[model samples]
Target chain A: MTHQDVVAQLIKLVEPYAEGRVAHITANTGLTGELALDSLKVMDLITDVEDHYEISVPLNTLADIKTVGDLASLIQKHVGNDA
Target chain B: MKENPRLLAVRAVRQELATLGIDPFGIQIDEILSPTEGLIQGRRTILAGTNNYLGLTFDPDCIAAARDALESAGTGTTGSRMANGSYAAHRELELDLARFYGKRDAIVFSTGYQANLGMISALAGPGDTVMIDADSHASIYDGCNLSGANTIRFRHNDPNDLAKRMGRLGAEASHALIVVEGVYSMLGDRAPLREFVEVKKAFGATLLVDEAHSMGVLGEKGRGLCEEMGVLGDIDYVVGTFSKSLGNTGGFCVGDSDEMEVLRYASRPYVFTASLPPATIAATRTALRKLAAADDLRLRIRENAARLHAGLAALGFRLGAPANAVVAVLAGEKVEALRFWHHLLKQGVYVNVMVPPATPGNESLLRCSVSAAHTPEQVDAICAAFASWPGARV
Candidate 1:
């Protein structure tokens, strides 16, 4: 999947947990600031994204991700890679 | 002039507590009346937050043992175990703990926090990986940080996530150390130890179960979740504290592996810190003996836990997990939780007011720990206090 496609999928996955904040979710939206997602919520979002894409997002990968765009790009990179 | 970071942090915390209208930190109980009751703020309060699970803090035998040791052995050890410490009582307690868990070796530490810090850091080094639960206690996180290993957190209580993370480690999976708690301290939920054992075995990862909350509260002989789940032998390390069920202050790590003994020499936290006082070791030894045979105390605490959990749930309070000794009542907002906690205190009941990011899920919790010493009437009074709180029911 393309990075933009992954971002769209991420927004949908995080919407229910974000408490109607999906309207503000975009590629540049900060996961913690704009969406007010805590570490646990971020983990939940990661789980949902992983299950939907059938890929494992290593926890270490989350360290460098700050915005929806960063997460989307990471997910895109891992989508089909066996690692 | 640039603002001092320390002062800035203190002022920020003070402002936050001022806004909440309650100071829940470092509450001083003017008098501890019993194992389960105390005088707080000049009012008699039911002590529901003290993690005295077996209620042996005031047990006659334990107190007597402590007194005798204090009288005979003097006060402090004055040095680390690697130095002038390692009194006879300390080694005896280690032997007792090792025998209690049916493990070959046990290493005692100054506190439970140090136990995790020492064990985890000593086990996994720069070349290794440590996989822990997302909801693990701060000590575990600090331990992982100290390990210098590439740390990864799997979703809490999810073995599939753990397995996947281990799989992602590729050839390094065998060097991974999987850490989880027998009973989580905050939410009072248990790890699926059986499933975790399977994952550990499949990945060839070493398993460490911190039984700080479960020790003397679960299993036939109260060895903790590993024993209760019938997978005691599979657990590579069993870490626990004496502060909870044993009613003292110290920690231990017991395992059958020969490498466990090397931690005594290699673990910095253990080598550098003063050993537990002679009195604490004596009292813990006494408590451990009682814990091995105190089935009645275990039953009472469990019964009390069930009563409090059921009563609170019936009153429309959101619970964090199941009806365990550590029953966490969820208050979605920090301000509301502070109000609920203050109201309960006013009603002669005391519980922990936990706020994020200290609590999991950024949730606020009125964490209640049940004890065997609490009477059924006292449990009802605690329940009634929660029931009467306007914010809690909502």
Candidate 2:
């Protein structure tokens, strides 16, 4: 998957759980400060992503997942497509 | 003083609860006389929220043992275990725990939290790695933090993910400690210990099983999940608590050989903190003996839990995980959860109102822990309360 594709999928996955404002979470949006996805929601989102993609996402990689763009990049590295 | 983030967060939490028409800090139960009863709002409330797994808190033997120690040893240790805290009872409980688990050594901590904090931090340091279940208790997470280890969380109860993560760790995997709970506190689901043992062995990672919620509730002799799974010899460390099943207040870590003994000298949580009170140690020793013979109590608690879970599931309430002792009623949103909690409380059933940050999946939950002392009528009352809740039909 390309970065754009992964970003799109993550955005779609996170839209329902994001409390209103993050419905339009862009690829460059910061997860905590920008999109307002707190730690619990982020963990829930990570679980969903793992289930959907059938991949294991390490908790240590959370440092790189600060932004939606960073998440997309990581997903691309794992799932082999950005989207 | 300028507004502080922590204080602001607390205020925000209060405001948020008020917005939802619920009090976040409501319902303080001042004095709990028995494991099954509490005084709340100047009224007697059924104590279903406590994890008194075996209901041995008020046992005559336990009480007498604690009393005897109180008379003999005075009050608190007044010093760390490394100093003046190593009483005869402390060493006795440690030896008794090691013998009970068939391990070479056991190290007891003042509290269950400290056991995890000390053991995990002592074993896994800055260069070492600690792989944990996503659903692991907060103590495990905090322990990892104190260790400054490279911490990674795998999916809950997913050995495949654990193995995959282990496979990815080229060299560090060998030294990693794969931590999991024998029985998860929230969902009351047992870890697939056999699968974990297999993957842990294949990856050459050490296994540490926290039996806090399972020590007296799982195995025949109440030795915990390791004994139940017949893999007691395989797990590197078995960490457990006297607070829940044992009906006392302390924690312990037992392991084969002298490795755990080293934790006594090395663990900062152990070395720096005051030891378990003499009365607590004495009561726990007595409780351990009772737990070993309290097969009937274990069976009753299990049966009660099963009945409650089945009844709640039948009532159409959304339940989390396959219930064992802990039955979690899933409330999707926080408001409905707080509302439902008040409804249950009004019905005279006291349960844990676990909200976000504490609950997994960002879910809100009403968690009930069944005890051997809870009569069938009480369980039925709990079930009936849920069954009668508006739109709560299964």
Candidate 3:
């Protein structure tokens, strides 16, 4: 899958968690800042992403995931990778 | 444009405690009358927030052992065990710990935090994964940071979540190191260890259980949840602390794995840190023997735990966890938790104010760690104090 396809899916998964702020989300939308997602909420979103893609996002990678684009890119890397 | 994250984090907690007019971080205790009583701010207070589960801190035998070692072993070890600090007593403690757990080997660290830090970092490396509980202690997280391993968190105490995450790893799960706690220190909940054991076996992963809170408090002989659940033989490593039930200072990792001996040379935390003081080692040795036979002390603490849990539940306060040695009353908002903590201190009942980051969720906790030394009267007093709070139900 292309990065755009991954971003499109992530936006849908992150929408419900972002609450009413979903309307303002975009590729550059910051997960922690504008959306104010706490650590628990971030984990929930990551779980959803992992489940949706059947991927394992390493915990170390979480530090670099600041925006929707960053996460979409991460998901894209593991989209079709094998064991 | 980069704001210091440290300052930002401090502001979040400081502003809340600032409103309460007290920090409660380092309140000096004028005197320690017993394991359950202390003088805080010149007021006689019931210390319900200590980790002295067996209440042997003031036991004459343990104290005498410490005093004897203080004279003979000359206070501190003065260097790291890898250097000049591995005394005969240190080796004896390791053997005692190994025999107690029925493990082939045991390695001691200067503190419980280092035990987790040393083992997790040494066992799992680059290209491997470490699956840990979502609510594990900071030491576990720090260890994962140093490991250069792919660290992932499963839902706290949820083995199914762990299985799902590990399954996603495909063949990578085989090299994963899973870390969990015996009794979670925050909410006082025990891990679903049996289910976790099944996950460990099915995935062919390494499992480490930190019995920091449950040691000397669970099982027939207080070997922790592993013994309590009949999974002691399945776990790869068992890490624990001497500060809690042992009423001393230090940490240890016991296992039958050959990697433990290799880790003995590789763990930087073990190689660089000063060894635990002689008094602490001597006191802990005495306490370990007492822990093995003190079924009465365990029963008393369990009863005390049940009383506190039941009393708070009856008060209509939102309880954080089930009956355990740690009874956490959910005070909710940060400001409110600080108020409740401050009020308890003023009422001569001192409990811990556990706030965010360390706590599992946003709900702040008035955490009470029950001690075997606490009298029935003291437990009643603790319950009464909660009832007296104006916002007890809120």
List each candidate's DockQ score: 0.31, 0.34, 0.63
Q: Residue B218 in candidate 3 has what lDDT?
A: 96
Clash numbers, per candidate: 0, 14, 0
Model 2 residue B391 distance off true place after TM-score fit, in angstroms: 4.2
User: Can you write out model 2's per-residue Cα lDDT over B1-394, one digit (the tens) per residue?
Assistant: 7878769767988888888776635768888878898887676778888889889989998999999999999888999988875888789999999889889989999889999998999998887889999889989988998888878778889999888777766777899999999988887788999999999899888999999988988898999888999999999999998889888888999998566667778899999999988899999999999999889998999899889999988877878877688888888777788888887777778898888778877778889999999999889989998876895432
A47 in model 3: Cα distance from truth in Å? Answer: 2.4
Question: Candidate 1: deviation at residue B299, Å?
Answer: 1.6
Which ten contiguous residues of candidate 3 chain B have the minimum total lDDT? Answer: B11-20
Overall lDDT per candidate, in order of appearance: 0.89, 0.85, 0.90
**Deviation from native of the Cα of residue B343 in model 3, angstroms:** 1.3
Task: Give the DockQ of candidate 1.
Answer: 0.31
Give TM-scores of the second chain, every candidate.
Answer: 0.98, 0.96, 0.97
Q: Write out fnat for all predictions, comma-separated.
A: 0.29, 0.36, 0.61
* Better TM-score candidate (1, 3): 3
* lDDT (10s digit) by residue, model 1, range B1-394: 8888759757887788888778888678999999989999999999998999999999999999999999999998999988885798899999999999999999999999999999998998776789899889989988977878777778899999889878877888988899999999999999999999999999888999999999999999999999999999999999999999999998999999999778778888998898888889899999999999999998998899999999988988889889999999988788888888999999999999898877887678999999999999999999999878764354
TM-score of chain A of 2: 0.85
Best by lDDT: 3
After superposing candidate 1 on the true structure, give the runs of residues whose Cα lies further than 4 Å from its correct spot.
A1-36, A42-83, B5-10
lDDT of 2: 0.85
Q: Cα RMSDs of all predictions?
A: 2.8, 3.2, 2.1
